[model samples]
Target: MLAQIRSIDSNFGRTNGGLNQNLDSLPENEINVKLSGKTKYTDYKIISHKNDTTIVDTTLTIQKEYKFNFLRKDNFELLAFHNQGQTFNNLAYDFTNISQFPDIGFKAKLFNYFDIEDVNYYQVPTPTTEIMYRTGLEQGQVVDALFTTNFSKRFNLAIAYKGLRSLGAYRRSLASTGNFRVSFKYETPKGQYAIRGHAVNQDFFNQENGGLTATSLEAFVNDDPNFSGNRGRMDINLNDAENTFDAKRLYFEHTFKLLSSKDSLQEREFSNLKLGHSFIRDSKFYRFNQGTATTDIFGDANSSGSINNKTSYLLYNNQLFIDFNSKYVLGRFRVKSDLSTYSYGYENLQNNTVGITKNKLKGDAVSFGADWNGRIGNFYVNASGSITPGIGRLSGNRLFGEAFYKKDSVLTIKGRVGISNKSPNFNFLLHQSTYNDYNWENNFAQIGTHTLGGVIESKWGNISVDITNINNYTYFNENSKPVQFSGDVNYLKAKVSKEFILGKFALDNTLMYQKVASGNSVFRVPEFVTRNTLYYTDEWFKGKPLLVQIGATFKYFSKYNANAYNPLLAEFTLQNDTEIGYPTVDLFFNARVRRTRIYFKADNISSFALDKNYFSAPNYPYRDFVIRFGVVWNWFI
Candidate 1:
C-alpha cells in the first residue's frame, strides 16, 4: 500500500522522522524492478509517497536500534511502549517523528504517552507472522505480535498488537501502554485503481510519581554504606497521581484512473491522471485521578492535590486529491493536489478540576497543497508547500524542499530546509491534571520553525549539522507549567560518527555538540554528548552458523539542567535549576543465529559499583543496575 498521507487534524497521528532510520532507499530487488520497468512509484516503507523516477540513496547508514545513541536509538529509553516510545532528554535536542498534515493545521498529540514504532504500513509479499516478548528487572515487561497474509496477488491484510507494563525503577512510577492496528491494501491487475485502509487503537496508563519531593538532592542521589539495594525506600513527590490517554482511529482511502496510456514497444501502461478520496475518524480521551494525599496543595493557588479531571475529543476528516505524472524539463515529473475538511474538539469535559475554562475547541477549514519530485541524471530535487486561509478561526501551514547528490556507493552529500507554522497540540493547550504540581491552560501561542541542515556520508563514517530558529517556542517551564516564548530562539547542532577496526576488534564512536544562541535562558541543551562502543566479533561453532559480538558502551552528556517529564501533561518541560549529569555505561553481548537476534545486557553498569547521582530527568533516577536478556524472531508462514 502507498504510505497514506497523515493529517494534522488526526489525533494520535504520526510525527517527524528526522532521527528515524532513513527510509528513502528501496530494497535491492525493488530498485532493479523500478529502473528496468522505466517507472517509479511510492510505497509504505518510506515516510513519503512518490510517483516519479527518484534515485533511492542507500548511503545513509544507521546503527542498530538496540543500542543507545543519545536515547534516540535505544530500545527502552524510558518506560518502553515498543519503538519510538517516550524518552527523557532535553527538549532542544529531542527527536520528533510526527509531521504536520497539509489539511487543517491542528493535531492532538500524546507523543510522550504512547509510541508505535513501525508506523503500521508495509508491503506484505506473502503470509508472514512475528511474535515478540521481553521482561526486564523490577517488574518490567513487553509483548507484541504481527500477522500478514496475501489473499490474492493484488490484495493483502495485516494485523499487529503490542502491550507494555513497566513499574519504573523508582517508587509509584508504573506505566503501561497497549496498541493495535489492522491494515489492508488492494490494487487492480492493470494498476489503474487502488485502495488502502487501516484501523488503530492505542492506550497509555501511567502513575504520576512527581519525582523526589526532598528539599536536598543528596537525599535521593547518594547511597549510605550500610544501606541495602531497595529502590522503594526513597521518597517521592506524589503517589496518588495517575493519568491515561487513549486514541481510536478508523481510516480508508481509494483512488481510480481518469486517463491512461500504453507503450506499444515495451508493453507498458501508465496512468497520467488519477483521482482519489479518503476518510478518517479519530477520537482521543485523557483522564487523571487523585486521592486524599493530594489535599494539601502546591504549585498553584487555584488547585488542590485531591482532584478528578477527564476530557474527550472526537475528529472527522474527508479529503479529495488529484495526481499527474509525465516527463518534463525538470526530468520525470509528478505533482499532486489535495483538498480537505475537518471537524474536531472536545465533546464533553469535567469541571474546574481539569484546570481549563473552555470545554471544547471546534472549527473547520478548506486546505490545499502540492508537491513535485524530479530527477535529472544523478541529481534530484523535491519541493512541497501547503496553506490555509483560516476557516472560522482555524489555520496552519507547512513548506519544505530538499536536494541531494550521490557518487556511487562511496560518498553522498545532501541539504534541505523547511519552514512551518503549527498550533500547539490540543493536549498541551488544554491539560487537566490532578496533581497540584501539574495543571494548565494559559492560551499558548502558535509555533513557527525554520530549519536548515546538511549531511555528508561515506564508508568511513558520517557527519551532519543543523541550524534551527524558532518563533514563539512552546514548552513547560521550571514550575511544570505549559507556556510559550515570544522571542526568537536559535539552536545549533553538529554530529560526527566514525568507527576504528583492527582484526576482530572494533571501536565505534559518536559525538554531538549543541548550542542555544538566542533564548539561552529558556532553550537548554548539553554542550556535549558522546557514546563509544568497544567490542569483539567473530564466527564460531560448526560451519560458523553462529555469529556473536560482545561490547560495552559508555554514554555521557555534559552537565546540564535536563528538562523533567510531567506524567500528567505527558511532556518534557524546562527545568533551569535542576542541573544533573552522570555517566551511564551499558555492557552487552548479542548474537544472530539464522534469522533470530538475541542479546544479554547489563544496564547502568557503573552504578552498581559506585555512588553517583544518576538521574534520567530532574528528580527521577536512571534505571537501577540490572541484568536483562531478550530475543527477536521473525517467521514466514
Candidate 2:
C-alpha cells in the first residue's frame, strides 16, 4: 500500500492542497487512468478552521525530530521541565496572534489544552490509521492513536486520543494527561450545503513539589556525590500537592449557498453566495489540592491542614456570516457578526484577611468583523478586522493585514502587520484561592500591542524578523500578584534557518536573536538562542528498502533571569535572583521502513560530560542523561 501511494503521488497531477490542479503537467494516459482504485498521498487531507488544507506528510526528516515531543510542535523557543507532561518555560514571546477577549488565565497548566482552532477535520478516500508512541521519563509512556475514514464521497469522520503518564526522575514530579477528540464533515453532492463539527475533552494533571528546598538546591548545584545517583532522595519544598486543568468543548458550523454560478469558467469571477452559521460551547475547570500546607512555604491558608481551591470558566459563541466572490472584489469577501457570553471565576464569594473578593465575572459582547482575500498582479493580499464597541469586559479592536509574493518554487516573501487593544487575561482582574496571599481583585487598564513582521523563504535559507511594542502590559510580579507595567515594552526577535546537504551528510542550523529595547526590568528574555544539527542519511539494503538517519543536535541559550513557577496558582512569577544558561546535546538514530518510522535517542548526552548546572527554572533542575526510543506508524486500507 505504501509503495502504491508513492507511485501515484509521482505520476498524477498534483496540487499544493488547493482547489486548482495543473493537468498540463500530466500525460493524457495518466489523466485517463482510473483513480478510484488507488489512493494518492494528496487524497488524505487535513483541513483547518480557516479552510486551509494540507496533505498528511509521512517523510522522515530532521524537522520531524524537532516536533516528536510531548506537545507535538517545535520547541525552539521553550524550555521544558524535568517531566514530559509538565509545563514549559518561555524563552521568547509572540504577540502577533492576538485574541479579542480575555481568557481563563491559568496559562501554565494550559500548555496541553486543545483549543477550537487546534482541532482539525479530515477527508480521505480510504480508512487511515496512525499511531505514535514514545517512552517517558521513568515508569510511564506517551501514546497517541488516530483513525479516520470517509463513509462516502461527501461524508467523513475521525477520532483521536492521546494519553501520557510519567513518574519522572525527581521526588514529586509526576505528570498525567489525556486528550480525546471526534470530528465529522459532510456536504451535499453539488456542494451547495456543508457542515463540519468537532468535540474535545482534555485534562492535564501534575504533581507539584514546589521545587527544591534551599539545602537541596545547594546540594544539586554543588554536585553532591552522596545523592548523585538517586535524585529522588533529594528534599523538596512540598511533598503532597497537585494541580489539574480540564476542559470540554463542542463546536459546529454549517453553510448553505443561496445562489450559485452555472458556468465553470464564470465561477472564477463570480461564485456561490454562502450564508454560514457557527456555534461553540466551551467549559473549563481548574483545581489545586494539598494534603498539608506549609505556612513557611505558601503562607497562611484558610485550612492549614488540607486545602482545595477550584475555579471554572464557561463560554458560548454564535456567529453568522456571508461570503461571496465577484469580479469587483477580485477573489472572496466575508462579513460576520458574533455574540459571545462568558462566565469565569469561583462560584462562592470569599472573605479573607486581605478583603472580600467577588464570586464571579460574567458579561456578554457583540462583535463585528470582515475578511478579504484577493490577488493584484503578482501579489496576494489578505486582511481582517474586528471590533467590539462599548465599555465591557470583552471590548476590543483588532486590525491585521498580510501580503505575499511568490516566484515559482525558488523564493517567497511575506509581510504582516497587526494592532490590537484588549483587556488582560481574566485571572489578572479577579482571583480567589485558599491561600490568603493568592487572593486579589483589581481593575487594570487595557493592553495595547502593535506588531510588524516579515519573512523571506528561498533556496538559500529562511529568515524572519518581528518587532512588537506594548502599552499597559500585565504580568505576575515577584509577589505572585498581577501588576500592569507603567512603561512601554519594546521587543524584537529575528530568526534564521538553513539546511545544507552534501551527499549523505547534512547540516541544519537555526539561530535566534532577541532584544528588549525598553522595559528591561519588566520584560526578560535571553539575548541569544541557537540549535545546530549534523546528520547523515542514506538508504540501506538491496532495493533501498530502509532509510536511516544519524544525527547529533546541540542547543544553547544565554543566561538571564528566568521566571519562577508557583504551583498554587499554576503560574510563573517574575524573579531577579536566578539566571539559567546551559548547553545540551542529543544523539539520535532514526530509520524508516515503508509506513513505519523508528526513533532512538540519547537525550541530554552532554550532561554526562558537563557540570550539572542546567536548570529549567529556579530550583528546578533540567533532565539528566537518558536513553529513549519510540516509533510512528501509519496504515491505509
Candidate 3:
C-alpha cells in the first residue's frame, strides 16, 4: 500500500476561549517551498485547534470565471477563482467579438419618377417651301417647351411654350401661330437679376390657286388699234393666285447685374444692364383672277366669259430697340462697350374693288460700338470701331486690329486687320404689284470690304490664313448696274490635334485643311477634313460611372456651282454638275445611372447626300433617318 501527504499551516495568537487545532505534514517528493529561489507546489493541508494560544476569524467570498480550451496550435485559456480570504481588486477582460463584412453592389437603379428640377429642350427642323401646287411634307413644325423652378433659394421661375404646324398635299394647312414665354429671377449676394416677358400671335395663310398657269396669250408688235380695244393692251399670261399673311409680336425685358469680380490684377470682371421693349403688327391679302380663254375673237369665236382681276394688301411694321453693354478691367487694360438705338415705321396698302386705301413705303437705322484690350509682356493687343446710320441707306464704317505673341508653354503669333461697310435689303427697296404687267423702281446697293490675316499656334499645331475683298472689289447691279464679274476671296486654313493614351483608352486625332482661291471658291467649303476619337472610362459603372465615345468624320467638297447667275439659268442652282465629294460618318452612345442619363446618336453614316441650293428654296436632297430618344433625371429636396 502507498500513501503520500503534505500539509502546512502557521498561526500565532492571543485570546481567551477559542477552540483551535494545528497540524502540519509534508512529504510528496519531498515537499518544498523556498520563496524567492523559485520552488512551489508543496502538496498541502493545514489544520488548527487552539485554546489560549488561539485565533478567531471570519471570512466568506466567491467569484468564478473559467473559459479554457488549449489542445494545441495557439492556445487560449483563462480561469479565475476567489473564495476563502477573497482578495481581488481591479481586474478586467474584454475582446469584443470579431467577424463581419458583406455589401458592395449596384450596377444601375434609381429614378423614382418625376422631379427634373430644370430642363430645356430644343429642336429645329426648318425645311418647308414646296408650294408650287403643293403635295406633301412641306416645312412647318417648330416646337419648344421649357420648365424651371427654385421657389425658395432666392426665388426663380420660368415657363415657356411654342408650336407651329404645316403638312401639305392640297390642304393640311395652319401656318404660323402659337407662343407663350415667361420668366422671373432674383438672386443676390450682390449680383444677378432678371425679368422677361414675351407674347406672340401669328396667322398667315396663302392659297388663291397658288401661282403660275395661264395657257396662252402673247401680243406686242406695236399693237394699237385705239389701245387695241382691250384697254391699253400689253399682254402675257399664265398665273393662278391666292394669298394671305398675318402677324403680331409683343415683348418686354429687364436685366441687371452690376459688377461681378475676380482679381489678381484682373482674371475676370463683368458689369451688365439690359432693358428692352417691342411691339409689331402686320397684315396682307390678295385675290386676282382673269381666265377663261380659247379665242379667235376679233369679237367672238365661241365666246366664253370669265375675267376678274381683284387685289388686296395691307402692311405695317413698327420697331423699337434700345441696347447697351459693358465689360471691365484696368491694369493691363481691357474694356468693351456697345450701344444701340432704332425706331422704324412702314405702311403699304391697296384694297381695290373700290374701297381705296394706299400709302406705299418708309424707313430706319442707327448703331454703335467700342472695344479695347491690352497687355505688354507677352505682347497682346486689340482695337475696334463701328458706325451705322441710315434713312435711305448707306452710312457705314468699321475697323478692327489685332496683334499677339504668347509663350508660356511654347509659341503663338498672330496678326489681323479689317475694314467694312454693307447695306441692302428692304425687300430690295419696295416696288409693288406685278402679274407681269411690269412696273419696278427703287434700288440701292452698297458694299465695301477688306480683310487680311495671320496666325500660328503651337504646343505643336495650328495655322490659319486669310485674304478678302469679298464682293467689294467690284460687281454691282441692283440698279446700280455694271457687272462683268469680279472676284477675290482667299482662304487657307490648317488644324491639327493630338492626345494619346492607350491602355485605358483615350485618343483623339484630327486634321483639317482648307484652301480656296484660284478664281474664288468658298461656299460651304470642305476641301478636306478628318476626325478620330476613342475613349473609355470607369468607376464602377454608376455614380462616378462608365463612359465611351467613338468617332469618325471625313468630308471633301469640290462640287462648286451655287451660282448667283447662269449656272445654267440659275435662280440658284446646284443640282449636280459634276465635281462633288461629300462624306459623313458618325456614331455616339452615352449611358449613366444613379441620376439617370441615356443617349444614342447616328448621323449620315455614309448616307451622305445633300444637295441644298436655296437662295430662297428648291434644290433638295437632305435625306432623313433621324431617331432621338432622351431621358435625364435629377432632384434634391
Query: Which prediction has more favorable TM-score, 2 or 3?
Result: 2
RMSD of each: 6.4, 4.5, 43.3
Q: Candidate 1: what lDDT? A: 0.59
Q: Residue-wise lDDT of candidate 2 within 591-623, one digit each (tens)?
A: 988768899999999987898889999999999
lDDT of 1 at 392: 39
Model 1 lDDT, residue 74, Cα: 50
Clashing pairs in 2: none
lDDT by residue (1-637, candidate 3, tens digit) is: 0011221111101011111111123223222223234323231111111112211111100000000000001101111011100011101111111001000100000011011111211111111010001111234444444454545434445455444443322221223333344444333444354333333443333222211112211121133243323321322222232222233333333334433345447664333333323222222222222344223211122224443322222222222322233334311222222232222112332212222233343333344545454445667666656565554443466776667776653576877777776543222233222221111233344545566766676656556565655453222232222232345544455556554666756555556555556434322244555555555534444454443333332333333332221100001222233232344444545444433334444544454343321111111122222333333332211
Q: How would you encode candidate 1's per-residue C-alpha lDDT over 1-637 as one tens digit per residue?
A: 1112221101111122222122244434322222224333232122222211122221112244243221223532222221222344542353221245322111212433222233344443445565555664468667677777768756778887777777765667776777888877677887668887778898877777777766434654556432336666767778787777788888877777777676567755432666778787777777666774453433442343465666666666676776665444442222333344444334444435554666566666666777665556556566667776663333667888767776655666777888887776665565544344444455556678888888887778889888888888876677666678879999998889888999988898888888889988788777887888888888789897677878888877787777766655556777776776667788888776654656677878898776657776776766667777666565644
The segments of candidate 2 whose C-alpha lies over 4 angstroms from its true place after superposition are 1-35, 262-269
> Candidate 2, which ten residues in sequence have the lowest lDDT sum?
3-12
| Candidate 2's TM-score | 0.94
| Clash list (residue pairs), candidate 1 | 14-98, 15-97, 15-98, 15-99, 16-97, 16-98, 294-305, 294-306
Cα deviation of 624, candidate 3, in Å: 37
**Reference-based TM-score of each model:** 0.83, 0.94, 0.20
Candidate 1 TM-score, C-alpha based: 0.83
